[model samples]
Target chain A: NAGVTQTPKFRILKIGQSMTLQCTQDMNHNYMYWYRQDPGMGLKLIYYSVGAGITDKGEVPNGYNVSRSTTEDFPLRLELAAPSQTSVYFCASSDITWRTEAFFGQGTRLTVV
Target chain B: EDQVTQSPEALRLQEGESSSLNCSYTVSGLRGLFWYRQDPGKGPEFLFTLYSAGEEKEKERLKATLTKKESFLHITAPKPEDSATYLCAVQVESGGNQFYFGTGTSLTVIP
Candidate 1:
């Protein structure tokens, strides 16, 4: 159903480089989130948006920023990328009012050298 | 503060063996508990969600049950294809669109 889609399956960046990970959902969900997963560590929330034009920081938002310009898109931007930011990034969306399960995208594997 | 913890960082079981993974959580007025299975190089797949204590849900060889403090994902006669990382997450009623996740339990069912 192409529930959630993320671009750039894999990426490599040098220290201090900046890039944006694109995420889009076809489910028309109002709640969208960006999370990063590291080896042996569970997924950590980076940033989230409850609806279009609304955004909020999550547990690990130090090096990342997110924007929700439309209901179908939530892009995560990494500024001055560092090794610590090298992790798999996943985007998810859900219908908060329905309390439904969140659907996740394939994920973007980012490696910062 | 909300927190989620999963036990047995990793487990290996022979095909057809049965075992249960644990997810302990603490939240301010629990609203929902979620279980997801993630394969290597893939995003997590939603498995089940429990809204309140004493709730139970089942699908194929997996059964998830929840209590006040914890939830359990029991795999019955699992197959090698069932090998994946199981993640537990919690959402609080008072929180605003925040879901707390555990490190996850990595399970490998060997043939």
Candidate 2:
């Protein structure tokens, strides 16, 4: 099964432009997360969803928004893309149980000009 | 606030040498700790999960141990293929599944 899948493997955005990053999982996991990794930096949590229709912010959520309408899809939206927003975004999923293994997508590299 | 910190931002080891990586965290109630190995341009891959203090888990050449405030990943007789960025993360029991990650320790095993 395709564990976790993300669309638009790469993208280049102009300032103030907006786009959505799509993430889907076939494992029927209840925990989904969005994280951004800058060059040589650790992954920063942007948003997370515990289940469908329940979304919450993490450490860094200034320029990002997320919605969980279905259990299989968790999409992140970038508003007013900034050069600082340029980074590799990753979508991850895991079971509801604690300390479980997490599945990750290939990642979407976004470069904002 | 919850946070995670890793030591030795970069590391170099010989093919037969062994070393330990550190991961420290600050959380009111830590539920679990996770270890991951990430290659350049690839997402982090799950390694081991530690649930309680004084707990240890092993796989192949890697061993992970956990305490109340920190964890360690010990690699024994590492090979060049083990060269990658090793990441440690924490999940707190605060009614959520969000993970806080460290900057990661870049390990390079030379032959």
Candidate 3:
């Protein structure tokens, strides 16, 4: 089973362009998260969803938005992308149990030029 | 603010050398501590989870131990295949399921 899958493994967007990074999970996890890792930096939370129709901002959510319409999908939208938004983005899913480790996708590398 | 910090941002070890990587954290309420290994250009891979202080978990050549303020990932007789960026994360009860991650330690095991 594909635990977690993210689309557009690599993308380059011009400044002010808009795009969506797609993420889906087959594990039926109740928790989903979006994180961006900048060079030489730790992964910063962008947004998270505990379940379908519930989304909340994390540490760095200034330039991103997320929606969880279905249990299997949580997409992150970037409007008016800036060069500072360039980073490797990861999507992860975890079960409701706190002990379960989060499963991560291959990640999407976005370069805003 | 809930945060995680990993020490020795980079390390180099000879084959068969044993070493330990440290992960210090500050959280309002700790739920769990996690360890992950990430290879270049890939996402973090789960390794171990420690729930409370004095808890330890092991897999293959890796062992992880947790204390109230920090956790240590000890690698015994590490090999070249163990070279990767090791990451640490914490899930706090007060954070509403958000996990905070450390910068990671880049370990290079020379064969």
Q: Which candidate tops lDDT?
A: 3
lDDT by residue (tens digit), candidate 2, B1-111: 888999889999999899999999998888789999999888899999999999999999999999988999999999999999999999888767778899999999999
Write out the backbone clash pairs for model 2: none
Q: Residue B76 error for model 2, in Å?
A: 0.5
At residue B93, what lDDT does model 1 achieve?
Answer: 76
* Candidate 3 C-alpha error for residue A113, in Å: 0.9
lDDT of 2 at B90: 90
Model 2 CA lDDT for position B80: 99
Error of 2 at B11 (Å): 0.3
* Candidate 1 residue runs with Cα over 4 Å from true position: none
Best by TM-score: 3
lDDT of 1 by residue, A3-101 (tens): 999999999999999999999999889999999999888999889899999998888899888888899999999989999998999999999774478
Candidate 2 residues lying further than 4 Å off, grouped into runs, are: none
Task: Please report the candidate that would top DockQ against the real structure.
Answer: 3
lDDT by residue for model 3 (B1-111), tens? 777999899999999999999999988889999999999989999999899899999999999999999999999999999999999999988645778899999999999
Colliding pairs, model 3: none
lDDT of 3 by residue, A1-113 (tens): 78999999999999999999999999999999999998789899999999999999888999999999999999999999999999999999999887789999999999999
Calculate DockQ per candidate and list them.
0.71, 0.80, 0.82
Worst 10 residues of 3 chain A by lDDT: A93-102
